[model samples]
Target: MLNKSYQQRLEHDLEGWVKNGWVDRQNTGAILADAARGSSSTKIPAIIGILGAILLAAGVVLFVSANWQEISKLTRLLLLLAAMWFTFVVTVWLKRTSHDYLLEAILFLGAAIFGANIILIAQLYHIDNHYPDGLLFWAVGTLLITLFLRSRATLVLAFCLIVSWASIEILEFAQHPFWPFLPVWLIAAGLAYWLSFRFAIHLAFLSFMAWFFSSIDLLIKWSGFSDSETGGLIVLFLLTSFIYGLVMERKNSPLSLGFGDALAHYAISGLLLIVFFFQVETIEFDGWPATLPFVILAGFAAVLVLGTFIARSQKIFNLTDTALFLGFSTWFILSWFIPALNHLWLQAAIYLGLTIWLLIFGQKQYDKLLVILALIAFGCQVFYLYMETLGTLLDTSVFFLLGGVLLISLALGLEMLRRYLERTRDPQDSRSQEVAS
Candidate 1:
């Protein structure tokens, strides 16, 4: 039955193919029969072997001549170009005679040529662009080739180009005076992500790496470090590796999620940390009012929370949302405890009230986490107030009041979640029983 339905859908899609003169309805049956027979496509490994042998031969020659001081850079570049051109011509010919594997071989050759050309040009000109022009050009060229050849190898090359560009740009930003180029690298990374989604290859790892590097660079800059400084580079690397592991588990590649999540997380964390630490010192030391940091932190925390929830709902579960939530929660608690906010009790009450509202609305959908976080937060607020001995009786009274209200709210919230789960499960059990019967 499922196969029949799939065939119907295929026939429906192919109806347009007949209209466009791509295929005919009368030949659809034959095409389907041929497809069912499973046409034997050429594997990529065969072409890889052939191209690998040729490249290895060339590499040996290049390595043998490495000690030759008389070899001009231009001569080396020309030789590289000649080799690439020859490979291209041969691969194209093989594509005509052989199969898809030849196309993949050509794409691999194109990528090597692209990188070699960039290094050669950099050496010949004695100039470092400090931007990802090489990677950009290679990615564009590889993307074109992928489109023309319809080869996954070319697409993978494009993915690698974007990932490499992101990594290089981040390193450049950290070690050179090239902060301005970061946005361009981010845009390129975004384009790579969009392409991956279209092609369905799951390059999330690449995207994550790009974002992770960019974010760390920005964090260092925001922390008042010079662009060329190497203070937080190690931390960035470690954090990137940790996050990369998480991203790889969820995405096919770390680059697949693009750099947006990492960008957001770093930006929010840096901004919050700056406000919490440096901003107040800078303002107060300069004889400015201390209230400025509070206002700035409050506004920033609000925006971060709003943005994080929006991203979470949109299913963007990268590190950014997690960081934003943490930042906002910390900011909220600190703001209440700070010397500026005299109405800590009132603010705690209001927060508890809002949390209860969220639990009530969210629990019906089995959102236990929301209610659980709210409950934990309520407990913390009460504990914080209890610890501070500013009118102990008054503080203890407020704590008990908030705690009682939260406990009651949690009981109701759990009941709602229980009912929702029961309602959802009953239908599944009934269906199972019906199937068994």
Candidate 2:
């Protein structure tokens, strides 16, 4: 009995040991397999990088060796189609890759090839005979590619294409200028904005450039100083600005508000400068007798004040107001000091009233720029009147007093209403929270 018991116990112990060993081995095998998979995954990025480099090199060679000028028109078209196909294939391959950087680099190279192909095709066919149509076709193709690949680079290319077309139109119109085409350009801008909502930030950036260039083109034409070359240069500047803004926005590590504000300011300033420069000459200064300047100044001031109020109401930072305000100030200083308008006192007064109105209404808006503009306008008004026209002060006293009283009353009423609403909402929120709890 003792011998049998010992054998049975020994067999049971050996079986338990074998089971434990099997469990450990299973776990060890799983860990080793996972490690091996990870090791293989790490190599994918390197492979993608290699492939991207090769494709980029191939694209460059193909672009240079195409002998675009020597090729027949049909041959050029065929080459363009082939280049586009290659780009599409490469883009698809990059999309399937696990490496994002490699994918981005490949997309950029593809975009370059895509743009080059269009330009070459245009050259071969002398599409300038159709003027804007050739550029428009290029824009459409690039825009379609952007939509398909969802590539930011393609979005930029589309923007460049549109701006190029618009610039050509502006130049053509300049020498034999037409009316009513401004609205068409605006439509193009709207299309760009619409595209941005569907695509990436690239479309927004491009739309901004298109709008800016259109504005500049309009300004130049309006100012009677527009030439094809100048319009082309403006288009180039618009692109440069777009690129600079994109780079700055991307590079900002901590993402300060100031950088974004500055960029917005730059864009707005560019747009306003274009508008003011174009319209300044046609303002009918002699007939209006200072009315035009006052109107212009007030228009900008109103835009600033209203824009601030809307921005505050929306609870977002909107630099449009600041842009318009700065633009107006620039025009005021330039127009006032350089040409030295008659009845500058009235213009200065109008500007001051508008500024004071903003300060009182927009005090709660948290925008430092708006407040500064108000102060500047006030100081300019006081200085101009006190130094330049002492007699006009007496005449304008009633106007200033009435304007100030109205603005102050409106500001106080609005503030009181806002406080009341906040106080009422706070109690309600607390009660809801208490009930939920």
Candidate 3:
């Protein structure tokens, strides 16, 4: 389902289209009415139903916990099985009755309870091989149910459980070449795509990124890849994904359905994250393999350049897009060569500048997702700069005071700059419109 805000905006646009004669009044009204119906339907009731189900599920668990010792082991086990069966039975009835919202809630609660059941059973049998093993079972079971019921809520839960189990196994147990999650993630990702669940796809992408970053260094060390090779591989992966997204965007591929917007964001974020690692590469300063980071920088520049040409060819290129590309590429490349950029203040400045660019671009394009990304980047940089610079200073209170003042000053300066840009750009925009007219 589309977000309420988006649906409302779409309805507004439809009404405008009617006035413009792009759509007939009758058709426009019909579409808007349908959108209103969709937007209003399922949201409030689903939310309330889901919340109630969660509370009821929790109550059941608490009740079980209170009487856990009173019941025999067999009885306890039987009760858990009964709960699982009962949930499924209720799910079937809900499906039969076409109560999809309540079904979703019940399915989610059932999946959660199933996880609890796994742990309980593990404890009952005194099975101890690693706690993640039980989680793995739980993930599989949840995924199976998710597939059977085609439930987005359960799909997300399955991904979370599986990703958590995989991360724990890899990080804590020194599990090498964690190949299992690749297939699991692929399956989950495929399912998400099939279901057109953008949120689930985002979670899957996040899970994949977590796995990649957590295991990349270890994978490189184990495979005897040098820093340059490791960097090259990472750069290649980022470029490939970005190019694939661009290709999909150009072609309007069905495969990109439900996630075209996210693909570009992921690509941009991957580049930004790579830039961040280079921004903090002090530990290995001795043998700093600048090759890969530089390659990534070059790749981004090339993409920006290529994209400019493509956009121009399509008559879609604009000043804002040019500025967005140049801003990020320049910041990324300059951060590498400028020794002064190593300072936390300078790093924060660069990040803040990028954040501002993203915000401006988002505003110009009316892309809410881009605005959200900008806010996230701003918050992250603020937190990082604070953490990195705060403890090193001798007088903590003074440091904080200075930091707060600096931030306030920067905010004011940025606002002034934004106003100046808007003022300057508006006249040029009006002139261009006059010329086009």
Candidate 4:
């Protein structure tokens, strides 16, 4: 779907094209009208249909709950089968009728019902075994339906089920369960790219990130690294994400899997957010032997800094990009020695500074995503500060007063800068287009 701003820009450009005799006004209007009609299918009807599906599924669950004890074992099994078949049949009918929104809704409902059936069936039969098996069943069933219907919505649901299943196994086993997850995740990624399911692609990336972090953490623990050493794993994760992002951007990765450098973008953003949350506390080590992880941390930091510089020289890394990587590395490396930097106040100050710098850099680059990330970081810092406040009247008053003033100033400055950039970029863009034409 087109972003609202982009949609507006398209309309504005279409009007200009109409005026310039580059396109017929009536034809442009018809094209826009067609797009509007197509988009409407995914709006109200889709919402209402999804809500209806959820309600219907809830009602089924309620019925099952009410009659579960009275029903025989076979009857219970038959009931679940009937529900699945009924939902599938309705989905097919909706598809045939070109009720695309309702079809998607029914598919989602079917997945929910299928998962419920997996758990309920196991429970009713007293065949309760490992709990995650239910999730595996749900994942497989959902994925089959996704493949059959070629539904992006169902694909997302299936991927979530798959990820959840893997996470459960990891937690339950207290180790990385790479056996099923690795192959399953690869299959999910392949399907996401093949179907061009953008949300599914993102889910796949997130699932991989979780798996990667968990695997690294498990490996570190197994290798006799103390819990204090896990920060090194995160540093490594961040470095790998940056390097991968540089590679992906350099390759000009295909859009079939959706946005380019999606893994890197998510990994970097997620790792930073995680660090903000947990970096306030320092984990102490016992002796010099425990300091081994810090050596690894330093190595990763150096690699990140060196790789970023190389990327910059190759034009893959912009100034803002280099600064971001180095900034994160600097903060992490400092935490290794100046344990006091993990103090709440210092962390808040660093986050605040980082957010402000991001705002300025994002404006310079005209990067809306980075600007949004900066805003989110600012919000996070504000929330963290509020949580950390001493709650004394004077401190509370001062905190609110300063925070309110700073936020207002930041908002106004960002707005003015964005407007200025928009105005300046438009003229340059138009001139470039004219020259190209």
Top model by lDDT, which number?
A: 4
Quote each prediction's TM-score.
0.41, 0.43, 0.69, 0.67
RMSD of each: 13.1, 18.4, 6.8, 6.1
For model 2, the stretches where C-alpha displacement exceeds 4 angstroms are: 1-81, 98-111, 122-132, 172-342, 359-363, 369-437
Q: Candidate 1 on 224-313: residue-level lDDT in tens? A: 443222222232322333233334333445553444334323432333333233212322112221464445445655554554454455
Q: Model 4, which residues run further than 4 Å from truth?
A: 1-31, 34-47, 68-76, 86-101, 109-113, 116-120, 163-190, 206-220, 226-229, 239-252, 261-265, 274-279, 285-331, 337-353, 376-437
**By TM-score, how accurate is candidate 1?**
0.41
Best by TM-score: 3
Off by over 4 Å in 3: 1-15, 60-67, 174-177, 232-236, 246-250, 283-365, 371-437
Deviation from truth (RMSD, Å), model 2: 18.4
Specify the poorest-scoring 10-residue window by lDDT in model 1.
279-288
Give the lowest summed-lDDT range of ten residues in model 2: 280-289
Writing each residue's lDDT as its tens digit, candidate 4 over 1-437 gives 45456568779999999997789987987877766666644578787987887788788777666656777878887888888888889988988898887788889888888876876776776676888878888888888887777877678877888888888888876547356788878877878888887777788887887887778755665677765466555656665665566565666667524355566567557756766766555567433325667677667767776767777786766786678757766776456445566776667767777677666765664667767888888887777677767566577668668867987998898799779989999999899889989
lDDT of each: 0.53, 0.52, 0.72, 0.73
TM-score of 2: 0.43
Residue-wise lDDT of candidate 2 within 1-437, one digit each (tens)?
55456555645665665575534544544644554555545656655764675576466546645665665767766766676577567667756784454654565556556656666655655566656766676666666665566555555556666666666766664522333334434544445444543333334444555555556555656654424234323423432342243334444524322244444435434533443343223333222214444554455445444544444345342354444444444444344233343245445544555456446434654546646655665665565455554677775676567767876887798789889999999999889878977
